[model samples]
Target chain A: MKTVQNNTIRNGIKVALWEIRKLVWNKAFIISLLLTPVIWGLFMGLPRLFEKIGEPAAAPTTYIYIVDEIGIYESLSQKVSDIDNLFLRKHSGPIDDLRNRIEGDENAGYVHITEEIFETRLISVMTGTGDTHIPLAFNTRLKETLTRYELAMHNVEAGDIEKIVAGYFVSVSPVIEESVDPMDRVRKWVPPIFAMIIFFMVFMSGMTTMQSAISDKRDKMIEILLSSVSASSLMYGKIIGNFFAGLIQLAVYLIYALMFIHFLGIPGLGHIPVHQLLSYIISPELPLLLFFALAGYLLFSSIYAGLGATMEDVMNAGNFQGIIMLLPALSALFISPVIGNPEGIIAQIGSYIPFTASIVMILRITLIDLALIEIVIPVVILLASTMFMAKLAGKIFRTGMLMYGKEADPKEMWKWLRQ
Target chain B: METLLNIRNISKQFGKNTVVDQVSFDVHKGEILGVLGPNGAGKTTVIRSIMDIIRPDSGEIRFNFQDNNNFLSQIGYLPEERGLYRDSRVTDILLYLAQLKEYPRDRARKRVLEYLAKFDLENAGKMKIKELSRGMAQKVQFIGAILHEPAILILDEPFSGLDPVSQDVFSEEIRNLARNGVAVLFSSHQMNLVENLCDRIFMIHKGKKVLYDTLLRIKQDFGSFKCEIMSEENIRDKFINFKETEKIEQEGLRTTIYLKKGVEPGQFIQKLPDNISIEEVTIKRDSLHDIFVRTVTEN
Candidate 1:
């Protein structure tokens, strides 16, 4: 037989192709890939759907039966004449009988104006449907009429009563000094949002990478494969394969989101200039952000791949291994705090820590215009830590994959790492 | 004989426990070397070291070949802890494994079909591993190991989980591979099969080598004749004083006497006491199984 020797890089690529085929060709993964965006679209569109369903077909005239003990019924009836769908009617019967008459009718309501309302300041409007909200215009007119009558009872002049009940109002209007581009809003938030996208992508992809390692050990295929290739090659293959898989998943989700926004005519996203947004993505900062994202993925995935080898099964993973698996999620916990205070101490410290650096740096860059050094120092730190983690994980993986039947304790892993 | 792989004074330890201590053996082309040991006897550890799945602490494992970096691709390994990806098709898993050895895809596919037919699993290439029975899966794993036509084949307990008929098929194929100049390191608890199949035996106990010689020499050195005498009464005390008897086992009416090495059965029977109720007398040389059991217990 001719001797066939594959190089390390080629072997790693082969391993990666195997992992990619295993994940991408599976039915369950494909189903989940197509279903996720559909589910997200449903969640986003359900409220708008309900609002369209709940809107009234046409405005029906509402009969407001007033039991006025204060005897201002004729004036009140005349005051409500201009409202097209609302009419006031005087009622002399008992308040209980009037309430029973309008109990089940949504268009019918009763107003009980007792003398006690002047002291308590509570106006009770009982409608047939329990959830029928009184119109704000109607509520304001009733309050104005009641205040005018109450002021007249106190011997105030009719013309002065208008001045007494007419309280002050404030209006807010933005003064535009210059034209605002609609894409400006999209530009400001896209970087941090993209950072979060990277974080989520890493989280999902890291899990598959870890599970792949565990599956290799569980299936007893590690030794056989390792005989043909090195352990480092296998680790690299898993990380690279899952990386592309995650990107494919993210692309699919983004496509569905854009399609939903376009077809459904979601208001805010409709008028944004697509070309300008694309230009913003292609800016120089994108490569920097991508570097952070790639470094972060490498950092956490290596740890996960290493720790997975120490586990006999996912269900029986040790506490230490389980915690390492969740290391990517640590960046998620800092999202709220860092977004709230981009220049604060928490964000600054998070940008220097390897685990949280990628996400926090992305948040800081997007939320605020940062200095060049602010990005550079964190990038260097993240780059160094990523390299360190990959090396450590290689050591741990080489020995841990051979262990079986029981999980490797931290001490045992430490020994392997040391070696 | 041309030595394809050589292990020189290899030792491996786990924590403070020495699992393989100063073990040395050579796998020659066209020879089947049987690795015999009880459980925890370091046979798997040595095989793994040779395969480069694990490293020895203080010894050298050298593949005596031209290419060192790609030596592993030329060695096929079937580990004792054997399994395949359960959710994957048999053909895909085998192809992937063969490709790792740098086997061409077209040749791998052709070889996969050939092996499948040879193992009577012609219709199982499209099926997932979980769908196959235990014996079928074993056959698939065996095919995966040899699909690349490796120069050296390291099989750790290859006959495990196989029926007698399947075992015979595997045995014949292994012999064929050896006859085609493949060095086979076969480890198994089935001593009878090993005695029939292997050209040489390397026996170990408690992580140490106890016997390393040709099969004929091993038999001559340790395989003594055993005498079985059936009587009406217990004959346990009758052979206690006989110098020719190395060990005695009495079970109710039957007494088995293991004679000292090189002592003929006829020479020892002449000294048998007369008037003993000897209903039947039979003499036979010890099989490899008995020799293995005796060597393990003696140490």
Candidate 2:
């Protein structure tokens, strides 16, 4: 009893240390964990810095020159006050001379108003530079003002004009019974980003697990290990070890993200409506999400462990890792849509899926005011699926760890499982 | 002494090919049983089966433990393919493996350092496995296997990559383990080492045990007979009457003869010329390599 207890404790400690060492020492893990965050911080932080630097520069006031003899200068000046950043400059000359003067001047543009014999009003805009926002804004406002003047001259009422303008408005609100929280827009983007980070952490950590499993098989280290512990114990130890290492990375990233947000003096982070953030952190669905995350890690990692065992070389292990990595990555594409409409059928169905549910369900818990039973149902479903998946993965891992040389086929795996 | 391990008729097959055919072996208290075979002769397969890395299709592996009933803690194995986590320090890996064998942290550390010192690798303990030479890695692997003072030690091709000095050091270690009453089974392709070190050998060819006995007995049973003749009679033709006469070579006035089976050396000498100029007629024994090749090929 003492010896077995001692062995188990020792095995656990060793596994934990091995995992921590690999995470700390591996170049890829270090680069992803340390360098990637720094790089992202620098890249994302540049825009804010540019905005700060340009904030003090005074805006150049807009200047517009008119070349029309239509006597519309008084009406245009009244409309120019309503147009943002437009200032009218009247030039007394023939239209050709006004156009020449306008083209020669670098800071102003000419708007020529004309009337054809058919009694149709014509407007042409001439500018030296096509890229300036002021020229485009001025020309659009001038045209609207002239059209309104022509309508008013035809005895059009002001109420009619309001109606016409209102018809052009596009409403973005969906026809839902419940009022959508404005914060839902921001919340929708958060889940996918969180899922992406988790995906990266799982993938990089899964690679470490793969290396451990394959190195054992290649070097016959598995034999030495098996002589000291059960196959299940070893597999479980490796999974737990890697999970803890992943938690370390997650914690580090969270700390860095918090520091970044704090350093940049971004508002709304400090005032994130404590109730909403707390609801996210302490939701009843959180345990379920964590459970699923653990289960998903084991399920995916078992495939890698099996691959590592079945293959004779490290190079072949990489080929097997693609499937393990792709399953979670493919699930990530649906995270955004699911978060946008978490109460939808697609999101609810995804909440039952082992890979998608962890992110999808957590997102629903945070972004949607779901009923208690609805939340409980998905959590239960995911937990059950996670259990079943873990059982299957464990069986596959045990059987696959002994195989070598050739890749393990489904038939052989089934046979081993049955035995 | 009680039996530590009992491997009863373990048979393993890969598809239709039987790799370990109804092989039965046992390890008792303090015995170093050397398993000798050529490449692909199922030595490694049997070792893996014993370690439970690969399950034998049909076999019963019963372990009779002492006060500690956990069989895993009592067995130490070094596989044919040597490996370590290339990124981990030597001492860390050793301590981890010792821990797997159920050693406590302080004890594991002390034991690992002691083994490192014993192997002349103490200075290299802090370095990673990748930084060590192949010989040094092999030493570390050996330390990993035996650090927990396991009751049964199984080593497959442990000496394959070791230099002469390292091989000697490993030999001494194996001997020391045996002296401390640990059952040790080591597989090797080097028949000379087996001949020199093993108390008893189990020689398998094509997954079947062809010979399992003491080294002296195997040498005696399967050895060839060689005789030198220094006769001036030119009587090579006279020896043709012997039915088992194989090859007779003439060097100047002397003749050396190799006799075939079923012909006794005493009987062949009985027919030789007496009172001749025979300076010496010594019969030489066969080497283990010769015996292995002949036995494997003949079987």
Largest TM-score belongs to which candidate?
1
Q: What DockQ would candidate 1 receive versus the native complex?
A: 0.41
Candidate 1, residues A1-419, lDDT tens digits: the string is 23222376788899889888988989999999999888877887799899999988767778888998999888888777788788788899988898889899888898899899999999988899976545677888898889988998899998898777877788665786544765677766666566568767977798889899999888888888887888888999999999888888888887775565456643766744445555656666777778888888899889888888888788998888778777767878888998789998989899999999988887787778898899889989998999999999999999889888889999998998777
Report the error of model 2 at residue B180, Å: 2.7
Please provide, for model 2 over A1-419, each residue's C-alpha lDDT reduced to its tens digit, 9 standing for 90 to 100. 67656666666566666667766677787788887779888888799899999796554566777765667788778766766566788877776776666564556677666555117555656665664336455666677767666667678898896575446757676677655664555445444445545656766667667677767776556666777776766776776677678878887786777566545533554445434533445445455445545555666676565555555666654444456546767567777888678778888788777777666766676677778787677667666765665566667666566665566766776676665
Per-residue lDDT tens digits of candidate 1, residues B14-116? 8889999999988899899999999999998888888777789998998887777688889888988889998999999999999999899999999999999
Q: In order, what lDDT does every prediction score?
A: 0.87, 0.73
State candidate 2's TM-score.
0.77
TM-score of each: 0.84, 0.77
